[model samples]
Target: MGWHYTPYGLPYIVSGLVALPVAVAIWKRRSMPGALPLSIFMFAMVEWSLGNALEMFRTDLAGKTFWASVEWIGTVIIPVAWLAVAIQFSGRDEWLSRRNVALLLVVPATILVLMWTNDLHGLMRHNVRLDTSGPFSVITKDYGPAFWAYVVYAYTLLFIGSTMMMRSLFGRSRLYSGQAVMFAIGVVVPWVSNALYISGNSPVPRLDITPIAFTVSGLATSIGLLRYRLMDIVPIAWATVAGGMRSGVIVVDSQDRVVDVNPAAARITGWSAALAVGQPVVEMLRPWPAAADACREHEIAANGKGARQSEVVQEVAGGDRSGDRSYEFRFSPLLTARGRVVGRLVVIDDITERKRVRDQLVTQQRALAAMEERERLARDLHDSLGQVLGFLNVQAQAAREQLSRGKTSLADGYLETIVTVAQDAYEEVRENIRTMKGVLPADWRFAPTLERLARRFERSYGIQTDLAIPDEIRDGVLGRAAEVQVLRIIQEAMTNARRHGGARHIQVSFAVAAEGVEVVVKDDGSGFEIKGLGGGNGRVREQDGVRADAGFGLGIMRERAEQVGGRLEVRSAPGMGTQVRVRVPLRESEEKAQGRDAHEDSGR
Candidate 1:
């Protein structure tokens, strides 16, 4: 059998016929975010299929070569268009800057130039002739490195472009995944058929079946446009989400390639947004090995371990930031409605200031507490000893008057009174010192401390004292503040009985009642006039620096009790007796805290 030239057949005519409207439809929606690139792809397919059909029908070498050059226009650009589609579909249109697009054009333009000037350098084809061995007339040539170079470049685009498209499909929403699935099918059909042809392993070896394959691709793309409305999702994502974010956000497919990274994400991670796109997550995070590891682990858990609902928290320390900084990252699975894990969404928040503020708050609280302690000490000194010292000066002056009146026995008794008051005041100061050292906040322990005060009064003044404080009072029933108030009140009452009222016996007791804890101190002694020294109200005079405010002790006691939501009563009369009573109330919650503290102290 003899070989002959073949003309346009049923397949070639049909492929060209099918591609025209599909190209127009795709072009019509070019204003969509990703559709511009898609339109370019469909248009290239129209040129390649139509020109290939015409070239195959031409029965002469000159006619076939001229049509082959026209076919090469789409052939040279189809891969570029496919790459652009991948870029746009993945929400990375930022990568296609004018400079990068021009650089992409450079190689393909050179290839087209070489094909046009093939007779001059024969770089594209070393020798050319009309092949009569196949059913269709086609140009046959001994191909050069330039021809192989074009082959290498096209396949490179195909492989990388397909990789990006597949990643786009993997972790997308249901509607998006369906549209991407169709786009993937559109992409795969031509490559598979072309690969078979280039390797001479196609089902029809000499027949160029790529155009027929492209026809199928165009149909699939058309179906995606009509069925899923792929174009609408892009503007929605761009306008509302991707552009407005302040926190660093990154999206990655199961392949771990960065499918999308916002400006904030790129800046925070120290990568250019355009350069970072299509890069492996590991490579982008190389400066942070721990973060990189976490990124890989989270993706694995999300996609493989079925932890689609789980999130991974990673703390990243230090970066290209101006000062010391920390960022908290939260990585979660991007899952479809069916619960299939598709991608990972990583969010980064700067937490350096938050940590610093927390530390500052703790320091301020400690300093404020110290300042309050010092203020409490100052107030304690003024209330207790200041009043006692002034009273002693008054008693010493009275004793001198008695001696001038030639009553030596009365003067000796007055001298003894002054000594007892001074000794009690000294002991009170020592107790305050111990309280300041460790007891804290105000040292109001009523049990042994108050009982000791009563006993000391007995020894100093030779005034037999009666003391009865319950076990609960000794176990710190009152807060330090409350304890100090009640104890000081008792000390003042005892001193006044011996020094002013001339009492021989003083009794102190604690009784619990429905009102609260009640402390009563009574004395059988000479009672002073209550009218001048706060008969009921705690009003005291402050003047003369020596005998000023003789009733200041009574005033302080009353004020202290009232401050802690407690009450104080004073009863005294000239040459009769004196009795002091106080009631203090406390919250149940404070009582529980006291118990807990006591238990902890006991353990120590």
Candidate 2:
């Protein structure tokens, strides 16, 4: 409010230059937490420094006191601004409501009112005089109760604000530690300097050097702004999100040291998230192998490009149920603007429920397939055997009546017809029994079982069957249900070759390929013409619901494959040999589905 020319104003000018630019820098990023408050604090410093410089250089007593009062505008408000900065920076902004801010303003407003009207009460300045103190005109003031009260209020606010910033500096991420240090120096310099001056311990008598201290504060905070981008954000933001997340999150530096861990991660590793930080994640999770691998950032850090994957089961505590929740840990490179890998961020998602629901769905599908299979078999019997049995009953009754009328030849003929019908029904029943093979392979891991099946077939039917299943393909592609379906498809193909194709040598070979798990069943037997069968292009499509009346029809075999989620292909010619190739795509590991398959097949 008051200005005077003075040589001591150079320090104030320098302080203004420093504080103003820092203020603008922070103001530009005012949307960030603590930025606006920091800007306000910087502005207050500019006002106080410039006003004090003017007050100290002025020789006239009235002008000295008036300009000193002008300095109150910055002095009264500095603490409030600092407190606001601390509150917002420390993630405690919810306490800073409109009412609280209005209340905070009241103290500074009252202090300003008292300072301007001090001439009436003499309570603010008690006694004031302009004196030549160390070659500079300084305003010397006798102590007043109001001025002491203001000192206590200002220091109290400073203490509270400093505590907030220090708490985060010590407890939060180390990345922002430098910024915190600079910020503390900036705030503390003015506090100590003012306390000394107000306590009558200033280096120069009758001169308040508090404004000069703002120069140092401004310089310290300016360094923080330029070097650390202070007030833009704090490392606590990362920890805040990581801490509150339901999914486990673990962050590691480039050196693979654990930098941050969420509570969920601690729950998984059985180590405290707070204490585990700054330790090696590998060391912390050594007791649990699966979880250790999940938290390990070494490989991802080495890769530098990040990783892409689906899901994997990471057991927490329990067996394969609750305590043993599934987690899909995704590893990504934490990069800067220049694409530098500073660290790796691992996001652990709990997928236990997803796996459980998927297993339940598969189980339901299998149940539905079983029910459909039963219905189809029942319908076949009703349509053929049921009618045959009914006809036999009628012929038997007719034969009995013919015999009762003394027509022995007619009764004998009816009996013969009954015998003929019974024989036809017997053949149809045999055919049905021959076509149905037990529900493929029961287990998802079917290499051993398939080998056993081949051996059994060779022994029973006098056919030389060789199984050439590779190791990788055995436990690779397709889920449990699909594997069972694929096995059934191959089983039916083998049966068709023996009964219809009259195959001599049957070879079952499978290999893991890029496309998927490829299975081939080749028979050097009397292969039938695929074109002549309804499977060829000329015939009605299976989608059209046209039933092929032929030997060993593939309608049911194709349906079973589709039901279990697989693709089936039957390639054959007149005598070139038949190749039943099945390519089942790979499925992401679903432990729940695999376990359910095992449970269902335990009886088999």
Candidate 3:
């Protein structure tokens, strides 16, 4: 059985056949990612086939010279091919320099030259008897020292290359470590067989199982490549796109089983996350019955093996895990490589906030339209109706003078009274129109606009009204809304004092506070029952902490307070003064003013 390479031939043949399919697959793939290893595996399988076939007919080769040429060529090419494969497979091509190729060629060329020259140099070969114990007398030649020398060079090249390959492959943790181990075994086993034969311990035949095993290694690595789609598989890429989408996704099979659910899908569905593997997507998603119709239509389109979509916005009812949430949904059909319909993929997004804002804006638009209509009516009444009433009051006073004599003058006084009543009626009409005109810019920044108001109150009303307000308000914290509220509060207090309390003194003060700005209006007036007062004329009155008023004046002030996250306080008692105080949170500059006040108070 010694020197019989027959059994080893089977592995080479099997591995070679396997490699054919794998190479075809790789070629079809179109990207030769690592060209050298793949090419080496391919060529090595072919080289092994040729070498094994030649070794099987070694003895008969001499009788047929052409056959002998083939054997000789196989022997020579096997070493070179093995070397090339090992160099490439182990990634030692960088070291396979031009100098190394030239050096390698020298010995083979020398062996050829010596064979042509009749072995005179005596290094290339020396023959030995092949069989001593057989009657057939097949005189097989033994290998010469040069042949052993070639063996050493071949083995050294392979060993070094394989070792480097192992180191490199093992360094990569993510790659096929098992394939690397198999290749190492493939390399080592045949070397052990060769060693045993060289040591004369076993008479068994030594054919290089390494090439067969190397082919097996190639097949294993290729299978790993195909299965894992190690670089990038099309299906995996598409699956990733489906999984990583921003909108909620749900896929259901024909049997209505859930197949997949993405991250966004989890948030919108409002159900304790259902695995998409085997649940009805409609049942799990809680889609309306109408959605099935849209899905059916889309599925019918998909029967043609083309993409189809159904864009539907549906407000799904709340599930057990989530409260209320709105969603915009889209359903599409999944497709396969051969353009076959797979299943439905449902895409959805949570649009609750968008709907909420849209509703608010619609309400605001309606309110704005009503306000514009009211403003137009107020302007009409002020320009037309108020002027006519003023002219009527003037004409009544003139007629009262003409209707007078000495005793008739008493009747004229009554006519004068009628004139006065007419004037009062006209003024009240004007006042109503003014109030209906809404809060004005002058009233809003009353600090700057109050000069004439103060003068008029002092001259005509005969009440000393003092105004102490800064010309340039530093902190714009006292915005127009806040300022209007403060001004109205002061005006109301002043009016109450003049008409009911007969107040002769008034003072208005505006000052920066530690936490906010403060406005105070105090008047020396006969204060009425604070509790007895209704939210008088729909104006603000305090009960507990909240104000009781439906009038726009107090409502505006309260709204301004709430807007700035501030507060208002009113203190009044009968037969004493009344104080109305407003506190508006200071911005940075006013806060600095507050800090200075605190420092001054501390120093004092």
Best by lDDT: 1
Model 3 steric clash pairs: 130-140, 258-276, 258-279, 259-276
How good is model 3 by TM-score?
0.32
TM-score per model over all chains: 0.41, 0.53, 0.32
State which candidate has the highest TM-score.
Answer: 2
Error of 3 at 573 (Å): 83
Give candidate 3 regions above 4 Å deviation.
Answer: 1-41, 57-122, 128-139, 200-604
Error of 3 at 404 (Å): 56
- Model 3 residue 128 lDDT score: 32
TM-score of decoy 2: 0.53
Cα lDDT of model 1 by residue, 1-604, tens digit? 1222355455766777777777787788766555677677777877888787777767778888888889899888878887887776566667788999999888899999999998999999867887877666667889998999988888898778778767656655442557877888887888899889888998976877887887787678677765565543332233224635888877665556665678887777877656776688778766666677788778667756558667888877775451477777788876432343446777777778886897799999879756755754565565556666677778789899999999999999988988877877787787777655645434344676766777766655568998887776776666566777777677767765665566788888888654468889899876656666645344444322212334755765686678777888877766668788888864454566679999997874
Whole-model lDDT per candidate: 0.71, 0.68, 0.53
Could you tell me how far off, in angstroms, the CA of residue 59 lies in candidate 3 after the best superposition? 5.3
List the candidate numbers ranked by TM-score, top first. 2, 1, 3
**Tens digit per residue, CA lDDT, model 3, 470-534:** 64353356665555555555655565556555679998887875566787777887654455444
Least accurate stretch of 10 residues (summed lDDT) in model 1? 540-549
Q: CA shift at 73, candidate 2, in angstroms?
A: 1.8
Off by over 4 Å in 1: 1-8, 231-604
The true-versus-predicted C-alpha distance at residue 88 of model 1, in Å, is 0.6
Judge candidate 2 against the unseen true structure and give its global Cα lDDT, from 0 to 1.
0.68
